[model samples]
Target: MKTYFRLLSFAKPIEKFAIPYVILTLLAVVFNTLQLALLAPLLTTLFASGSANATILTKPAGWADVTGYLNYFSQQISFTYGPFGALKFVCGVIVIAVILGNVFRYFAQRIMEDFRIHTLLNLRKSVFNNVMDQHVGYFSNQRKGDIIAKIASDVGAVQFSVTGTLQVVFKEPLQLTAYVFMLFSISFKLTIFALLVIPISAFVISKIVKRLKEQATMAQHMFGLMISYLDEALSGIKIIKSFNATEAIKDKFDSENVRYSDLGRKMARRQQLSGPVSESLSVAMVTTIVLYGGSLILNHQSDLTGPEFVTYIALFSRIMQPAKALTNSFSGIHTGLAAGERVLELIDQKPEITDAPDAVSITSFNHSIRLENLSFSYPGRTVLKDINLTIPKGKTIALVGPSGGGKSTLMDLIPRFTEVESGRVTIDGTDVRKLKMESLWSLIGVVNQESMLFNDTIFNNIAFGLPDATQEQVEHAARIANAHDFILQTEHGYQSNIGDRGMKLSGGQKQRICIARAVLKNPPIMMLDEATSALDTESEKLVQEALNNLMKNRTSLVIAHRLSTIQSADMIVVLEDGQINEQGTHLELLQRNGLYKRLIDMQTFND
Candidate 1:
């Protein structure tokens, strides 16, 4: 119950609708109770041997106190006849009350539905926006499917908690309470005996609910894992087929599927038990009440007559249905609370990086970029140490080194993807940490070895970074990157939709499209990290040409694994074991006969 209340707090923003919804719910509860309670009068009159058309004043014996109150309200509001008016009046009141109940219920449900969808939509947007603001390293450690599950499945669970649980919580309890109160008014001693079973049944239900909640939480987590497995397997289908690991992957998936199914079945079994257990207990209590109340009528110790006893029994039976429903709803609330906890866990996570209060935007770059004795470590090991370098404005600097020599880490530092432990990175004259992240990133463009494209049209992909770019500007940028020719040859040309991650296009084509996107941005600085390493010789030539065109006048920082690519670089910085080992032009480094010369010789030998 505490967990449910906590989950409900997430809907606080939609609290303005709560009052109206509660009012309508109360009205529905009243009318629904009246509809059931109306049966008592018709039964009483027919059983009492009075004229079927007896009026309210002429037949005080037939009219229960509650029924008389209802009759008075109905006659005051509308038409009323004399002795035979009660029947018509009761029937008419029931019809109008039912209509009003349903109408209020309809509007109340609409308000709740809208509020639930709106609140969940806002929560999803907030989670996505927070993820986008995080440093790149945050995603590097996360699975794509897991993140997607958090956004889609987990957030959806919260919506169910808000809307579905709210319906049961508000409606069922009000109905149950109204019925119980009516029972109390008719026969207090009998109602007391009937009420005794409630707490005992509730205690048993509570024990089952504790276990059910634990299983439900486990089931949702397993579902997430299953989704992630399917996502991973589908994304790597080509690789799996090439490796002939289909059966193995299938076996793994089947195992996970079985576990997920078994857990779900267990949860279902627990939930299924709740309904029957509640119903069975309710039947026992109703039977006991009939026997006990029948004895009272026979002994003439109660004020009620034969017809009144029958009416009371009929009204008391109505309580069981709603009582049963309340128990079922309680179980649902428990499961929903478990699901909401998962979603709120993600929403509560604090991002590793964010804009500072004093952060300001930098509109232009006038000075050089400086790395002052920078040092960085990951987890337990240092990756960069005492690395000092100066990148002058309007000049190109290339980082060339063996794998794991911290060349990529050096480029990562410029963007503060991983914070430095002992030094600072300054862009122009201001520390990058002091500048607003948006302004810092706005000035830089990065082109990685693998191009990332969404499932959208070619034009949209090229214009991704610059959303407001005109068609002509996109086309011109595509032309500059050598992507225009192939795009035009496609079925819809630039308007053609690319498949997921641009999987429909060849590697070279995707790379060219990525280059066009970077070209469209036209940032002041560029980071080319092994940008042509994945291409074949011919594609490499084309991409390298496009890259050269893009980097012509920009302050470019290139990290290259292939020695040939950086042969004509203006300056090359050689890194080995987290520190600079050599710095010179290609020919100048080769003349030094050191680490750079050794690397060139090794490449020459491989060729």
Candidate 2:
């Protein structure tokens, strides 16, 4: 229930629409109840004989003063005609009431539908925006399928909850109240006998609803797991084929599928029982009424006429519709609460890194980047230990190390992707933490080993970081990275669309376009992480040339897997066991004969 209230808070942005939507729903309920109660008197008047002297009707005691006003107005209209005129007027009033009820219902339904879609759209956008804003570490622990499920299926469930619950929450209670009041007016004692079953039925339905909520929560979890398994299988199709492990993956998917199917069936069965149980309880109540109310009419103890008694029975039976609706609505509320909890979980996650109070904007970079006694760790393992380093402006510092030796981790510190545990990283004399993240990050360009590209045109890919870049500027950047010639050779040149992750292009082509994108951004600081390590000799040569051009006259940090590539670096720092083992020029490190020398030897022997 608290989760639902939190979800309702999202409606605050559109309160104008929501307020009117609720008001119109209440209005529709009023008319619908009026139309149903009017049936009792219309039937009584219809059964009267042509010459029978009809008794002047007294105002119904069950309604408040507002209903009394309506009753008076209806009676005045009834008196406009002759003796049979009340019956004719009653028929016309019922027709108008139903028409008006439907009209209000139509607007209410439209408003609700709009509200659901608009709110859902905003929620989806918010989730996607949060996902985009999360750090790389956040994605490392999440499954693509689960994220997609949250946005698609889970969001749809919330929308259904909003719309479905609105109808029952407003309409059913009014209908039930109107029916109960009409029944009591006809014969108070019999209404009491029938009403005794309401609380008992409510209790039974509530008990089932508790179990239904548990099943719904389990079902949603199973749904997330199933989606994650499917995502894994599809993403690793190549690996499965290479290892001939299709059967193993299929079996795993089947296991999750079985769990999801079983949970779904259980949830559906629990929800399915609500309507039947409520209807049965209502049937029992009706039976009690017939037995008791029949005795009153038979013994002449009650003043209800034969036709009035019949109308009372009809009106009492109408309570079952609303009771059934209310019971079913509780089931929907349970499902919604479960989904709302999941959404709230995502919405409530605070980002690990954020701008601090009094953080100032950095408009320019000068002096140097200083790392003082930096230490960092993951959940259970330290990745960097008391790292001390300084990088001056306009110098290329190459980080050479074996795999898992904290080279990439060191670079990640520059952009504040990961925070240092026991040190301060100062950029141009100001601690990076004291500077706004957006301002600090805008000064750096990162070209990763895996070239990240979207399914868009070559021109758009180059201009991705610079949305306002002109066509001429895009071409100039491509030329600087040596990608312009190859791009022009393609059918559509700059307009040619790349497939997902740039799978349509060769490895070197992808890398060069990534460089082109970086060149277009023209940030002062550049971080290249094994940018040419994956390419063949020819492609590597071309990409290296482009990188050389981009790195010129920029403060650069390069993480290289192939040590030979960084032999000409202004400074090479070899990291081992999360600490710097050697630092010097290529020939100077050879003289020292330490970890850097062993790495060169290994690469030479492997080659």
Which has the greatest lDDT?
A: 2
Per-residue error for 474 in candidate 1, Å, reads 0.6
Tens digit per residue, CA lDDT, model 2, 1-607? 6777676666556676778777887778778777766765566556543536755556656454333334445555556764378777878888998998899989988887777777787777777777777776777888777777777777778778854686578778877877777676667777787877678989998888787667777778778888998888776788999999999989998998998898888888888888788888888888888888899889988887676677677878888898888889888888887877777677777788888999999988888889899998888988899999999999999999888999998899888998778898999989999999999989999999999999999999999999999999999999999899999999899999988889899999999999999999999999999999999999999999999999999999999988878898989998988998889889999999888999899999999
Identify the runs in model 2 with alpha carbons over 4 angstroms from their true place. 50-87
Clashing pairs in 1: none
Model 1, 174-240: lDDT tens digits are 8888887777657778778778767877887776666776776887787778888899899899999
True-structure RMSD, every candidate: 3.0, 2.7
Question: What residue pairs are clashing in model 2?
Answer: none
Q: Which one is best on TM-score?
A: 1
TM-score of candidate 1 on Cα atoms, chains taken together: 0.93
